[model samples]
Target chain A: MFNTRSMSKLLVVASKDQLDGIVRELYRHHVFHIEDFVETEEEGYEGVKIGMPLPQASAVSTELLRIRAIVSAFGVARSDVVPERKESVSALSARIDAELPQIEAEVSDLVDRRNHLESAIRECETKIAELEPFVPVQVDLSLLRGYEQFSVLAGHIPAKVELPVPAEMYFSGDVSGNLLIAIVPNERLNEAEQFLFEAGFQSMPVPGEEGLAKDRIAWYTQEISRLRAEMEEVDEQVNARKEKHQTFLVACDELLTAEAERAEAPLRFATTDTTFVAEGWVPSENVEALTAALRSVTNGTAYIAEQDFDPVNDNVPIEFDNPDFSKPTEMLMDVYSRPQYTELDPTLLIAIVFPIFFGFILGDVGYGLVLLAMSLGLRRIITGGAGEKLLKVLRNASVSSIIFGVLYSEFLGFALPWEPIGINRHLNIGAEAHGHGPDIVLMLVVSAWAGILHITLGRLIHMRNARRMYKPGKHRNKVVFGQAGWILVMWGILFALWSMFELPLMPSFTGLSPIVAGMNIVTLLGAVMLIVGIVAIGQENSLELLELPTVMSHTLSYARLAAVGISSVAIAMVVNYIAIGMMIEPAMQDLSLMGVIFIIAGIIVFLLGHTLNTALGLLGGGLHSIRLHYVEFFTKFYLGRGKKYDPFGMIRKFTED
Target chain B: MAVETMSVEVAEASARGLVAIGAGLAVGMAGLATAIAQYGIGTAAVGATAENKDIFGLVLVLTVIPETIVIFGLVVALLLLF
Candidate 1:
């Protein structure tokens, strides 16, 4: 399509209220108009009026409501969906005001409960700390065992009596064998040790024997258990408080949501800093009322003027004007950007090709079925209407895979015992015993044909878009020469190759067989087409011209079809061989269980690997297909320079959150 | 004994080769991802700067966004080597 751009400017002077009314009207119609009323610099700001067709008013209303619901649900503050009704906003304001006290009360109660629990925990911790120094302790048995040679110290020493009671009693930390430790800092050790063990048990201690510190260690141990129990109780209380807070938060959210949809009986005008001048199309009938309203709000400062409206140009790329009834599936097409809608809606196209490619790459019937089932199941699991939309795409792709798998005549790692039902069994080319398998060639050729078709359709879209934007004459060459030229060159090259390598010597040139000689002659025309189409479509950018070879190479790159098919077969063969080998001896010995297990394991592995490969293959193939469509195909005639439609009354700043 | 030792060394050599190959693949993928992510973020950063020069500090932080991916890769590679 030829690129067409038009620029216009408008200015309006009105009271703040009238300006706001105009802005609200513009937002209701999805008309993007900028309000440049900055108190600071305002040099780049200009007003523009975007037009809408009167016939689409209801559709516009539905779309606006949908957007509003989505923004409300998702918590986005974009009010441009439907102009916020003044009555509703004021009602919401009143509700927020009424609910503020209750919300604050609940929050205060939660905070109080949390604080009480925290203080209780602190008091428990303080009590535990006070008792920590007085708990009992046990002796280290390993250290005691190591010093067991001095076992005579186990029992009480009766001032140098015969060997004391058994060593076990002392090591077991009994009080009978417990000795008083010196109550001394290092400086008074001599005096303190003499006052205790030195004076009471000289024979057993001999000399330089230190008193025991068991009682002190025991006191700390007992305190630890007591503290742990107290902390655990406090923890339980804290958890209960946290749960209560969570419940309060949930209630708060529900309350706010209910408030948004609540009915109200109020009509209050909001004070405004918002000011806008909008240009919009109305049925010449509504223009009178619109003007009257503007006059009333502006106190006679507003004006209405007529401008030519081109519905086709306004919604170019999107077929919103008069949709073709024959295309029932157009409802599935989603526009990422309205202005670039026509040329850029490649997502649905990608959705169609991705699964087909994935299944082909994977090439395992069992795996394909599994993927279909998995996707369908996942779709069922997803909740909400939005989830259902995502599921719809997955469901479609799964169906495509199931179809492809049936066509491929594969089930698990084995070929179907009989031809699939419904498909003409006798005429099935896929199952024919041609060394490379007739289906592989058929599939590869189809892939190439799909590529050709994609490029052609993209060109057609661009041609329509170009003309719609009023650049019909400039892109005429692309429709006639550029598009048809590439198609011919591609087929011509194929025909020439077939004739050179595939014809029978002579009499073949008889009737329809001079097609070879004709092909040779057609090769020159094809070559010329290849050159002209490339040059015309590329728009003469030197850097883009460098991409010519890359695009051309990828056009032929569907050869990966053969590569993927061969890999699938090779992997299957290796796995099958290993399985058979493992089971051979067992089968001979009549160990059917082992043999069966081997076969099952082998199939599972083959299925798993092939399924993964196919999935990845489909993704790569689909993305590559779209890349070709967007860059090579659309570049032929389409120009994507339209600005996206983003209405005002929305924040333009990006926060990291 | 020599043959056994030689076989052991060969096996170790192959294990090391596998590690090297895996590391190379991991690093290469990470680098490519970082480059793509950085290109998008960098473009946005430039656009932000064009809108407001005062946001320069924020712009610098956003521009460094892709560095994290590469740093993760580097850390993984270091762990594997050690």
Candidate 2:
């Protein structure tokens, strides 16, 4: 498909009493993209104001919030469980009113108990760890604290220190550091503190409890185990509740969400005292069905009519009309932006061209096979999301890579059994290997030719889009002519080069007799076209003439296809040379224990090197290929910042109407 | 006479070595230029991506737009070597 789906503007008018029926019908049809009404001092809007939400909106929102809380408290994620069956809205509403509060109470009670138990366990654990250093000192905790006449210093010190004043001291340490406890008379506390400070002492808090350190630790550990067991019991009770009510809670959530949306739909409509008006865009083909649905619901009282809209003036929402196979490439289009409603959609073209560029850049059988397997494997693991779509794109690119690999006659940088059916990428300049080494010049030229054709196609698309988008006028003609000029200049350059040089895979016109001075027919034609094209471009915008060099540079840019591929091939070859020629071969001849170890090490090197190369190949190939499209190709035509189509409806998963 | 011929051979070998060095510099300097350009673009792209992740594809394309310079260098290097 070349364009987005055609949209028709719909205006619906009904009495306020019929608003509910109209809204329900429209939502069910799921074809209308609502355009909200904002009050302004515009003609025909004098009596109308923004509509208010239905009376049930607040109640529906409250219920939805409660359901979400239950879902989160149970850690029930949408992806965590599959929807078993759809529940009717009536059944879900009944369950919500009857059972939600009781379940809420039970869950909150269990969650609060679990939280209290967890904090208590943390407190006990902290106490045990704090008292752990004191265990080796063989002191009672009561002796360290609650002394009326004696002051104590207990903590770690850099080294053992003798108390300056008379005191009882206990010290234990290893080469790293020491823990010390000093008990002195209150009068001599200053002296003990000064000495400890000089010894780099870091103080520890003394526990207020009364018991030996080891005994306290033992008691705390026993308490912790008991609390942990209780915690487990609480968790099991919660799990049982989750198992029983997860499906219901999920269904209620779905039902309430849809209800909330419906209840709030009035806020987007324009309302007067007695009537309401709704305006939205619907696909042109669905207008009849929508009108029928609305009329049936309103008992022929509601007025539904299609309004005339100009695509140039109206901000119509764009929904891509690409075929199913090209739908995934819409993700690529989204990365830029959606195409404007009247503009051409390039999804199909990208689907066909993007992978070809990727394949050309990463043409190697081994890497292609590995990437294909990885994408397929990852697809099975992650399904039904953007990640799966990306994997699908990668799978297509990998298939292309394999096809190119066959043409290039390469398998992980090694020569295949047959000679290259396409351009050879390997370079063996002087050696008579593989008939002839890679034609580097030919590869670059081919890449450039690919760029020329791709850009030319882009310019052609731009010209067509311009003709369709603009009315017949001088301005429209200028835009179209500018695009045509760009195409002509590119081809003219190609023709001039062909005439001047004996390029590979190009028609040689240099052998033709010169018509005047030294210029042949091809060169003369190329010159005339270049002058005319430049003039045409200048007429459109003289400033654009400064960008003439870009045509040449962009053509050269596609040479990255060959250049990056060659680099990858070179890395693979070096990897193989080191792993096999330098290490494995020598080890094979030696045939000893060290030789076996070397062989194993070589294999590791081989695998690691290839793995790293494969990852690089994917990154480089995909980025460079897409870059050619985004920067060089798309810059010629694409202007995408269109509004996305978001019809007001729900695609129910866990519940049904 | 023997010494003269040996000196000429030495000159040819040095010339070949010099050409190799030239090719290496062409690619290496262009790569450095690309890196310098990417340093700023890449950091800004990362900051933008942190704010909103949907623009990652666009920023990725922007970040690599400068890499064409290195590819140009590679083309030059290939011409020199082969």
Candidate 3:
């Protein structure tokens, strides 16, 4: 159950005529992950050309593209309603070909009218801008062009600039003076140009349009309004057409896409003139359902057989099988990477260990209750995908935190009425300055023990893999010895550390007398094992001796588990202290109205403060707990190098058959 | 104020000052170390997340691992005051 299901290759052969129906049935069932069939030329096997898409594949694909374009042009959003009617390929293809032209023509007529109106509006607007310069001057367009001796030096200037020019050189433009039509004598044009440049001007050509300024402006306004109203009418016509065919277009696109996929699927198989053979992998348990489905689909004309399982082929895809409660833990595996076909499926292990670490770090009944309410109570809002996955993992963490919280007798960092089952934190830190609920020796002992146990599990898995893989022309013996040696050395150091620390959880060795001048039997025995294991590993690489000290540091890294949790509890305590200092602690001392107000305000602070701390605790606790498993535990044995099984099938998110 | 009383107040003030300074060094130095470690990992984590949003959860877990060092230092500093 902890291992990947051993896979068997399957060979499916069917008549060329029944191939399409067979493949469609297989897809709708979604059991098989198809593998491209490879041909060999040794002995009975002679490789031949692989199959190609059928003659109808191109037609279906083109139809699909047309339907997609029609839907997009019709403003049919994916979430809009789609008809459930399924159509035969020939009928859909024929209908799409016949109706596409009429639909295209109908839509284009409205589009052409709207596009024409838009262009007319743009031209009118440009003319209006050109006539703007003459608006302030109150000049007739016909009069400005007839200037003889005084040539109008018309040009653009920076819109915001205001420069005083000679009275004769009248500047005529709106406040946005970008269109300037200044009239100056022909001889003075040179001096005027220099003056204009210094005043931030860029020369522009004058328009030959003839009419009074007011009339031209009025004509442009009226023309633009008329064009816009016509455009609205055109838009209404297009929208009505879209409303009529939106559902049909969406449904047709889905149908054609599915048909195209079915038509092209045969390209992955090998085929003779009359027969086709497909190769793929199916879970052994699903073989019966698959075989029955194929037989039913083809009227028992198709044949399916289980091929030999190739033990040496490392290409087998991994599929996790875990109990329902542990299923969410698969998200952890997916986010990191998949385990190899030969590697242990660590989903169940993660399910068991991940929450325990999370709870240990964020051990508080108050926070646990809040987290539980948010996770379970807010489930309806969380709905799906990443949010739901987070809630599921948080559910387990909350439950464990409640359990650990009970042991610690902490309710939001305040002591509950009940006695503590494990650590009475008030007495641990409140009475003694240096003492703490988590910084004590007991927590350290537990962390070290957890680290040692975790590493041992990894090394054992490594040893089992090495032993199973024993083969000729391989240095498999060293692999086994190397793991065993490390295991011994790690255990020895763990026992030695335990003897040196006087922690509450340490197993008492007082029953036995010390051996070899003050050393206990356990520590001495551990030292001897450490020497032997070091020597065994040293046989492989002398430099590995240098890494032995690193193992001790690795063991000490587990102290983070204690460190993180202790800090979290400390934060909770301070929040409670401040809240009480402001509210409840003084409520009993005074029965005044001000005290009542203060108490209410303090309650608000308490809620807000604990909420912030609890959120941080969740982030810190969740992160560090998983970090221990990913960095400290998995690196010991699991080397995840596997390919994901991505079979050919449309997710059909936007449209469905 | 008498000379003896003044000296006693100054001595107590100096003692508190030393405690505050000690606490600051403990937290400040640990925070700096954590920042250095996180900057390297955080850059890679953001780049990886941009390429594939699916790894966001994993990267988040890895990114906060260095924070424990600062939190541990906070605990030590708090204990030192006591």
- Which candidate leads the pack in DockQ? 2
Best model per lDDT: 2
Docking class of 1: incorrect
**TM-score on alpha carbons, each prediction:** 0.51, 0.93, 0.77
The Cα error of candidate 2 at residue A595, in Å, is 2.9
* CA-lDDT, candidates in order: 0.43, 0.88, 0.75
Task: Give the docking tier of candidate 3.
Answer: acceptable
DockQ of each: 0.03, 0.72, 0.31
lDDT of 3 by residue, A359-384 (tens): 87787898899899889987887666
> For candidate 3, what is the recovered fraction of reference interface contacts?
0.23
* 1 against 3, candidate with superior lDDT: 3
A504-546: candidate 2 lDDT, tens digit per residue: 8778898988898798999988888888889888889999999
Lowest-sum lDDT 10-residue window in model 1 chain A = A261-270
- 2 versus 3: better lDDT goes to: 2
Give the true-structure RMSD of model 1: 15.2
